[model samples]
Target chain A: MVDHVGLLSAFGLIDAGYRQAVQVMEEGGLDGSTSDPDFLVATGSEELRADIPVLRHDGKLNPNGRHMAQQPIELILLKQWASYLALPVWLIDDSGNLLYYNEPAEALLGVRFEEAGEINADQLAEHFHTTRLDGKPYPNAELPIVVALVGRVPSHDTVRVRGLDGVWRILAITAFPVEGQGGRHLGAVAMFWETHDS
Target chain B: MKVTLWGTRGSLASGGPDTVQYGGDTAAVELRGPAGEFVVLDAGSGIRPIGEQTPSGTKRVDILLTHLHMDHIQGLGFFSPLFDPEIEVHVWGPGSTTLGLRERLTRYLSPPLFPVMLRDLPDVTLHEIRPPASFALGSLTVRAELITHPGPTMGYRIESPECVLAYLPDHEPALGVAEFPDVPDWTSGFELAHGVDVLIHDAQYTDDEYKSRVGWGHSTFDHALAFAALASVKQLVTFHHDPGHSDEMLDRAMAEMSESHDLEFELVPGRVGLTTCVD
Candidate 1:
């Protein structure tokens, strides 16, 4: 073990130079720098959320096949269907974990689905800061999406949520449970559209 | 601790004259602890031979499956102990949200696919394991974690009194990474493999082949070497040989790879019936 550790430290110097050479070649030998003005502006700005993880804004790697491989086929299809629809849609698994939300939904959520990544049911409920129309904190169990997820039933309601940008919006949401051919409850889908600002 | 590779061929089992050197069988491995504890990893077609070799005195055997890929579990029905009423068989595997291990295994083990049902095998127990699960098998301590694979796959860390071994037969740590081998803590199977005595990892594709096969749940040799270096593993057993690669091609590939990279650790090509001991 001691010998291996010693060898690892010695190899670090060679490995670093090797990787740098590979990177230089991969970047077309341009010194690994970008001269794009848009990139410079994006990096120079302060509006970019410092807390958010870096995502490839182009949505190329967002929700790739590997990320969806373990999900039920029904849920996978629903995610695909949501991706094409202009309406905002949120897909949650049987455990009510937030699997994904479409681009339109991303706009309303004030964060890209890639940026938020996958959040558990509990964390998601808290992340959205959902409340009833009466200005009271809404129980997660009673929320339309959670109700659909838990009961395998359709649910609809109007609720207020604080987006990631700290803007509160009143939205109308309809959620329905998704079931596969063998009576397996795959997951639930929630479609929402903004009605007004809260 | 003794680690034996019963199978190394990936994707499919291709037994022919060309593959005799590497032994064409899908992923099945046996790890024996010093205290007579027996553990089998995967039930690929290679497991048929392992079942034929099982000692009669062995009362219990545990099979830890990484995932339910057909290539990984196709030999479950052929495993001899599952049919023996005297021997206890325990199968552990990852489960998805809608289905548990038993339910998932039932899909392949029942009816039209196979003549017998999973339940028909007396004394066979199926345990649904979630990642980050730890358990003890006699003298061996095993830890399982979800890895970057297409399905609900797991990589295992087996620690015996004498040594530690990591098995990640199918993985793609560079799937979405801008740059791979970023850090030991950030890599997929690094946690299980870090500083282990032996790291049996996926090296099913050449870097050229991997260019077109990204996100296919396997690693290139370059990625494997980088990962081994980052983890500081003492011995790296390059596993999961591509079914298309014959002995000659594999030898040429390895020779080229050796010339290109400055390796710091012992590199061994995984092969059937090859046993390495840690004491």
Candidate 2:
């Protein structure tokens, strides 16, 4: 068994917080050893993990470890992966429900995911005012997230979005459908960065 | 409401002496309401003849495409009204995550595929539809809903003042399930087809053929009948015939199905140029 903790630590990927979490996990009788790095990434106990971002392995996450009986593992992994991303990331379900947006995304949207919760596709359209580069109001049908949710394809476009702060920001957005094992459409994820002002 | 089947064949256009009785065109169906609403269900090769026979003084025609599969949209460029600047041609298709309707259609309508680009076409407008959406074309109200298919495909429910007609030419309502018509609410395309006056649905394979081609996004006659029964549709017009099945084969299959099954609704084999008035 390759010690994942020592390996990730050797690569300088683990910080002080991650080391402490690992120490606590080891103290709690987890054995804290696995041949596969990904297995170690996926099976962390909830209380020990806390808010510390853990990299996913082979598209699996078990925040509640083997006890995760509810949400799909793929989504849990994606949410964790997104949380660690410095770039703004938004995760939506197959039905177009807003599932999660990371801390970086919350800064840009001017709201937190906990407060916003799961916004349905229809309400999402009303929440953000989007416009095309030519200043025409962007049709909901053309939005990258809408396209990704409906068409199940990767889409990229530049549009202006009005944040909750009432400021319009030009963002070059790329959204792609996330399909799980056996070609199941898990949902879609969108990552956008602020571009030049409109 | 008057419904006309211009093309009944599915997959590919299999025109030959063997297909003469049933017609070899792909899926283009035309619907007209008493209030003068003209709608084309798909742009399959069958659409060519319908375009040739377009009524004079027709101002606008809405082409509601279920999906962008080649057999479905093959007759689009050949549709004459797209060339007429005097008429407005609206092509409504299922939206994709990758490209807009115009861009996706352009791949087929332009360059090495075809001579004229979708952009070069006159009086042609592209409309992207996200299913479970309701819209109106004149007096006819149309409800588009996403169904179980390979891509972003939709089944349409068109309701007029007199009658309701549902069209789901390419659907697999029993993809994952072991026993079909599991639950009314859980069945794919159930709501669009439920209790409609007429349902034109996919019957692309026989039961045995479907076993080998599961998840191919087409329904077997048994599956279609089950769907129709669950929806309580008054008349079920079997559509999207497999390209390999000859007229004689289809006739024999239809006969076998009718003889073997105790069905509740009227069943009719879809044939090109068959017209029905639902009242």
Candidate 3:
């Protein structure tokens, strides 16, 4: 079995809540009268084994490991496997800062993960030239990503944005808040598909 | 449905001469059902008045509390209906994962906080409720949505065949760093109050007070008015008057306000005993 301690800390999942959750995971599980079961571990405790080599490789590739420490364990799992998905994935912390995006998402943003270290929610909107799907005015606060982070509820909306190629892409996005135990918000993730005119 | 503003003062109870006109009870409102069923909102000090007004033969009533803040629930013990065996009051409120509504209410309803225990109230049934859920309250379709607040807070929309009335007694619709994890954005408030005939909302601050008190989970009169206008609600009742605000101060908040030519809607500062019919 992987050393849960080394794996969690190595991934830079270093928030106080995450640490407290790990402590519970070590002592026992909340299913059996665990004290102060604050956070829920999205990933199981089985780690360090050669079978789960992807997490190890991702930890090595994490440019923002120091920053990832602030994210919840569930978010860490998203960071690890989100890039592998065929769909473009965008992740933001509970505070609504752009934490990371998959390669496909980066291609859409026309920026790179390494090049753009951290961007606030507002700055990302300005960079993308986001607008309402209806071609009407859209407020920064009402962005699907912002709604997901602020409302802590799953939201789906279509937005028109000027992509890097100077083409207006109509993207249908569904965003849901990442939460730990007791409904504590971890962050939010957005999955999107760009509709093209044939 | 007929609505009565039994308690309008916000934060704390202040019963004095200055508050006589608006009355100094904290958040409680009662909606007399069209078919004689009882539906009440919150249990603040205003519940005492409801308990007194309730007739003994009233068989069933549902109390949907917005949250468990002290000011919102301090009058529960004083509410006499819980002691009567004849009335079956079903209490519903938002609950955390670790605690249900009844368990969390023990914080104030138990020995240390009050003499009576929830267990003693055989007539009262506490149900742990979450929002984004809708349930039928007799003929009225009641919808509850999680709103922006410090704890697990909720706002409600009550609809009848005749008209729709949305009540958000304790809410801060403005966006800021939220304390709770899943608290919805300000748009949720607009959605709840949208297209309703009467929107009774928290107007607990002035524009000046709201500056320093931003993110405190309360709204100013301007915020309340703006929401009522945006939602296109027919009438707005500025509720949850600040405890420090006297009847005179409340009068000025509404008296100075006028309906713009572009936006025509009736605005009234809420007062205890003022009844508004949802028609």
Highest-scoring model, DockQ: 3
Which residue pairs clash in candidate 1? none
Q: Which docking band does candidate 2 fall into? A: incorrect
Better by DockQ, candidate 2 or 1: 1
TM-scores for every candidate against the unseen true structure: 0.63, 0.61, 0.63
lDDT of each: 0.75, 0.77, 0.70
What is the RMSD, in Å, between candidate 1 and the native fold over all Cα?
18.0
Predicted candidate 2 versus true structure: per-residue lDDT over B111-217, tens digit per residue? 89999988788788777764445677888877766777787788888888799899999998887664676545446777678778899999999888987998799
Q: Rank the models by TM-score, top first.
A: 1, 3, 2
Candidate 2 chain A weakest ten by summed lDDT: A36-45
Tell me candidate 2's TM-score on chain B.
0.98
Which model, 2 or 3, shows the larger DockQ? 3
Q: Which 10 consecutive positions of candidate 1 chain B have the poorest summed lDDT?
A: B178-187
Candidate 3 lDDT by residue in tens digits, B41-150: 98999899798888868888788898889888988888887888888988878777577666798888888779988888878777665444466678877766666667
Which of candidates 1 and 3 is the stronger one according to lDDT? 1
Q: Best to worst by DockQ, what's the order?
A: 3, 1, 2
Question: In order, what is each prediction's RMSD in angstroms?
Answer: 18.0, 19.5, 15.7
Q: Cα lDDT for residue B79, model 3?
A: 82
| Clashes per candidate, residues 3 or more apart or on different chains | 0, 3, 3
> What would the per-residue lDDT of candidate 2 be over residues A81-117, giving only the tens digit for each residue?
6867899999887656567788889977788876875
